[model samples]
Target: MATTPAPATKPLHLVYTVTNIQHKVRMLDGTKVSYSSWVKLFQLHAKGYKVMSHTDGTQSPAKTDTEYEAWAEIDAIVLQWIYGTLSDDLLVRVLVTESTAYEAWSRIKAIFLNNKGSRVAALEHEFNNLTLKSMSSLEAYCQKLKELGSQLNDVDCPVNDQQLVLQLVRGLPAEYDIITSYINQILPTWETACSMLELEHHR
Candidate 1:
């Protein structure tokens, strides 16, 4: 089988016409616990457009390579995509005059990785302290707990299904005391726990 080589100029490709990417994906808020999801969304976007290599260094061509200039151009575009999606604080920290897409990407990643310990502690504390009284409603309590649990998992400090179920049962208002005690007797998944609580609320 014969294969046609790619164009020598990067921007000539139709996929290089990316703009307003910041509007497409949520910007990177430096203090957010949802950093992993944001990273996932950006990677998915980059992969769909055939530009993952510009950020991951998987297909990097050296300065002396024939495709080097084109690669650099594509990389710069990818860098701009990242810059556009970053919060002002984050952009200021990672931006460099001559940085490659991979350099900026890795530096930002390092920043999150280095703070994982503190993030884990803070999220865990908040999750543990969360209760139905603190939220607007039963649904809100569940939603916030789930968000915190997911965020903790993203930071590599996961709370297991059992723990989530337990925590959900633990935070109910006084009216839920009887149902909460009943729920505590069983080993339900988090979804089941939420459903049981809802059933109790309606009854």
Candidate 2:
């Protein structure tokens, strides 16, 4: 007698659906946001959907392997996600008929992350945008800003302690306006600024 087949409700292997990835990620306009941020969100999306290997270069199967065709199908879906999320100008530059998801991903990443200059620019942009939100503790905000400044310092673009202090002041919540004004008048060191912010945070 013939055996019964697997349940029809189960999705078959090799079946993939469009993620409409752009809605989950912004279109990379090469200026609106840093590429690292864009790519991080995209990678997180891929990881959640269990398709990260397609874009990360660690899971290519041999053509003769039984899983190869299914892998290719998923890879094609990943490639589509990459293409769909890119701006038209970026799409034209990195899009190639024969590219795998990994190839396209790397090309786009390199466009913004290739040089020391680019890295510094990106880090500074992120630092400049940092803010103390209600959801984050005051300590964390100060620490993150310091870390970004340190990263800039490490790249030979040293953020003087005064500049770091000013940046931290800029990100302060309005409740700290009085102390921030005092801090600015003093033009204290970053360490001094953090201490002031922390004391204000507790009040």
Candidate 3:
């Protein structure tokens, strides 16, 4: 029988609070963390106001006083969240005298989003250079690979199944050659490959 593996440690969660509204999720450091944080942050604010895809009236009808008021409230909350979550250094550098939540959000996005290309390059470099050392635990190796793949996906540069499977096999030590050969023949999905590797580790 295959023994169940212990679960991995979870990352710290990031929380946002203002007035009656409270939101929390795993920590976000702009670049290292998953881009899902970006989506989640927006969604949290979207609950109170329309933040995503908001127009500036040049293309559509101008907002009414009531609409503007509601927007302003949500923007303030979102701004608070951004200010609260960012590191002291980043907060100091990115902070601007913007009056609206949209402006603040756009400024932060401009700072981070513009670096996607460089971030993608760095991730790919790490992926290519990754290798399972003889002393390393298989679980740790697998976790690292999955993390890099996930971060890449978050930034709009997804690693396909075949590439992930291939990379894993290629990076294994020589002792894993026989199993790697078998894996190549089967061409299993990434999750299945991970399970098989874990099972092999147990054996």
Q: Quick one: best TM-score, which candidate?
A: 1
Q: Enumerate clash totals for all models, in the order shown.
A: 0, 0, 0
State the displacement of the C-alpha of residue 111, model 3, in Å, after optimal TM-score superposition. Answer: 3.4
Q: After superposing candidate 1 on the true structure, give the runs of residues whose Cα lies further than 4 Å from its correct spot.
A: 1-14, 30-33, 182-203
What is the alpha-carbon lDDT of model 1 when measured against the actual structure? 0.82
Query: What would the TM-scores of all predictions be?
Result: 0.75, 0.59, 0.67
Judging by TM-score, tell me the better candidate of 1 and 2.
1
Give per-residue lDDT, candidate 3, residue 185: 96
Per-residue lDDT over 1-203 for candidate 2, one digit per residue giving the tens place of the 0 to 100 score? 99999777746533255446777878876555346557778888888788888777796989999989878888888888889888898899998879899999889867655687978888899989899883268777877786677666645577888888888888877888999899989998777888888888788
Which sections of candidate 2 miss by over 4 Å? 1-15, 118-180, 183-203
**Cα deviation of 120, candidate 3, in Å:** 3.2
lDDT of each residue in 51-91, candidate 3, tens digit only: 44331222222466555654555556666766666666667
Overall lDDT per candidate, in order of appearance: 0.82, 0.79, 0.68
Ranked candidates (lDDT, high to low): 1, 2, 3
Local accuracy of candidate 1 as per-residue lDDT tens digits, 14-126:
34767679756788774443667778889898888888877776858779999898788788888889888888988888998989899999988887777888888888899
